[model samples]
Target: MKLALRKIRLLVHLLHGMWVVATRFPKATVQQRDALNRAWSLRFLQLAGMRLVVHNDAARLDEGVLVVSNHISWIDIYVINAWRPTRFVSKAEVRQWPVVGWLAEQLGTVFLQREKRSDAKRIMHELADHLVAGHAICVFPEGTTSDGRELLPFHANLFQATVSASRPVQPICLYYEDAHGNQSTAPAYIDDLSLGESLDALLRGAPLTAHVYVCDPLAPGAERRVLAAEAQAAVQQALDRLQPVTARPAREAVGVQPPEPRVDVPHASHAGDAPAANGPLTQ
Candidate 1:
């Protein structure tokens, strides 16, 4: 019954979205139109049972900026879109997902082919064009999803897009909370769980909450590698300070381990990170 309601809501949203796209395609500036479209997407996610907590830093986010964020659950896209207008730099396979693929295309997502070295230049060029056109593009530099307890090291390659375009890179942190107010562990790896299993877990879990923190955009002129590292550090700091206090039993919580001693610059990026675009969106 819930699934049936969700389908009905999605169909309504799709129809409304198509109407808006057709009506405003020629009249509205890209920013104005995208802001409205993204807002609707966010509202749909909220109706689908995702709660959002957002923190906006000093960054104005005006003009074209490369927004870097950590990936956690499949719904991170909706969480991000709820707050601002932005396009995503995703894996090419997302261009084929069922309804999601259609939505992504409408959102103007830039699809990357990571396995093909030759595609890097093309992806970079496409990214540069988006920046030049004054569109905000979101990239998951960690290149994959994690359990929300720690951040993965960002891939320096995507930072090159910001460097080449001479645009600021905004760092964002995302954390997902479970029913017991703890981080979820079931949906980290794309290959670790089947779609049915993941959906079941989400449906059975307590209302999921996503916390989003936007840090100041990095200044231009720094090395892309240094910029990436700095962004990674900022995101880690936000996560450390903002993770909600969990009330779940120790054995049942996903991130119940004791906090470690503080370090000046803790390693946020985990090793052996998988590609970000590998799950249902890719299929």
Candidate 2:
């Protein structure tokens, strides 16, 4: 009964959030919109019984940079947003998700259709322009989620935007632990698990604490592949230092080579896409 009530309350809160975003977000200035986004994210985490702990030796940078992080669950987006509102580059299919999809669009997420070469090129140009204009744009170079126990291969394709704009790469490390401080797997949205099952698992588990550690930003100028590897190493090292006993190995230990620069590789297979000629960058 308590679980059911929690779900109901979350649903109501989501609907309320949508209304608030739809009503006030457009009229607000950039700073005000960012404030609203952070507040909403905090409340969302609270309702879901998750606590956010940010470990930043230095203050969060406000300048334009390419933000890269380890992806564990869809909840990672909100975890970062709660700290500072950021523009995210997500797969195009995410734009079609239910309520959250529309909210993502309103919040300034760039959706990428990886299968189409033209679409990828367009997104690359837009991302570069945003970074050049001093806006932070985040991309999950892993291109997918993981179990939060190991770091997956980071796709080097998106790293090109940072290089194009000559912007630094900000690497963030994210992980979850229970109240007792043990690693929590409840939030891992890996494998064939559906979104509903992932949410149910998170809501039914003990209260979780998510750590977002802002690591040292790597300076730009290197090739995309090099930048991707360096960022991945930085995140993995942070995760290692955070949990010394866990032995979180990189995926390479099992003979997985770093993925080549995939200019046209599809991130995920999606059904038919309607053709569009010359659409705006933000959708």
Candidate 3:
């Protein structure tokens, strides 16, 4: 029954989305467009049973900056847009995702063809132009999703755009968790999975909490490699700080012997994600 409701909700959303794509986009201003996009994206998550939590060093991000984040799932874009209205630098294939693709094109997503190395140079200039025009652009520098397990080495080439635009780059770390506050695999969208297959995984019992950690922004500099490495480390450290606690071996749980003690970061309090439901999968 939950799955049936999910399918019904998606059909309604796609119909409304198509109407927006055909009618509203032709006449909306940039602000108007993003406002509408934000509304839809947030509601889309709610209806899909995903809860969003945003924690940023600053109260809100500036309009024209570069956001670097680890890729996890297609919903990652919406989770960010739920807080900040921005464009994305995505691969060319996302532009082919039927109804969703058309909406993304209208929302100003820049597409990159990874097969052509020169395309990266072209996209760098394109992103820089957008930044110069005061648009926030996001890039998944790892070039692929790791299902929230590892931080892949960032492709430094994308950072060149931030340098060219002289825009500050901010790193955000994300993970999805079930009701029990542990990492959940229900939404993992990796490896040969079709969109329909992914949606099926996401539509199970309840919503998932999207854990977001926003770090301080890095000043753009000439060395893209150094910038990339710094951003990677910031996210890795954030992941370490936020990852779920692991249980000790079976013997320790049974109290046959004392378990090895561990140290943890000391803080008076932590800002945790608000309520959201989740099933069991990975993306």
Q: Which candidate achieves the best TM-score against the true structure?
A: 2
What lDDT score belongs to each candidate, Candidate 1 first? 0.65, 0.74, 0.69
Stretches of candidate 1 exceeding 4 Å from the true structure = 1-27, 185-189, 244-283
Across residues 1-283, which tens digit of lDDT does each residue of candidate 2 receive? 4888888877776777778777776678888777666766766677788877777637357778898988888788877777677898877876787777787787778888888878977888899999999998888888778777878889888888888999999999888888777778898888888777888999877598878878789989669999999999988876765553634453333432332221211111211111111111211
Q: Over 4 Å off in model 3, which ranges?
A: 57-59, 247-283
Error of 1 at 269 (Å): 38
Position 213, candidate 1: lDDT:
75
Order of the predicted models by TM-score, top scorer first: 2, 3, 1
- The superposed Cα distance between candidate 1 and the true structure at residue 8, in angstroms, equals 5.0
Models 1 onward score TM values of 0.77, 0.85, 0.83
Q: Model 1 over residues 1-283: C-alpha lDDT tens digits?
A: 3765755664566556656665665577766665565556555554455666666644548678988888876667756666565788778887787656665776677888878999988988888778878888888888777666777688887778788888888888877666666776544545577655665555455366666777778975557799889999888766765664443323234543333232121111321111111122322
Off by over 4 Å in 2: 57-59, 247-283
Against the hidden true structure, what lDDT does model 1 obtain? Answer: 0.65
Lowest lDDT 10-mer window, candidate 3?
272-281
Which of candidates 1 and 2 is the stronger one according to TM-score? 2
Measured with C-alpha atoms, the lDDT of residue 71 in candidate 2 is: 86
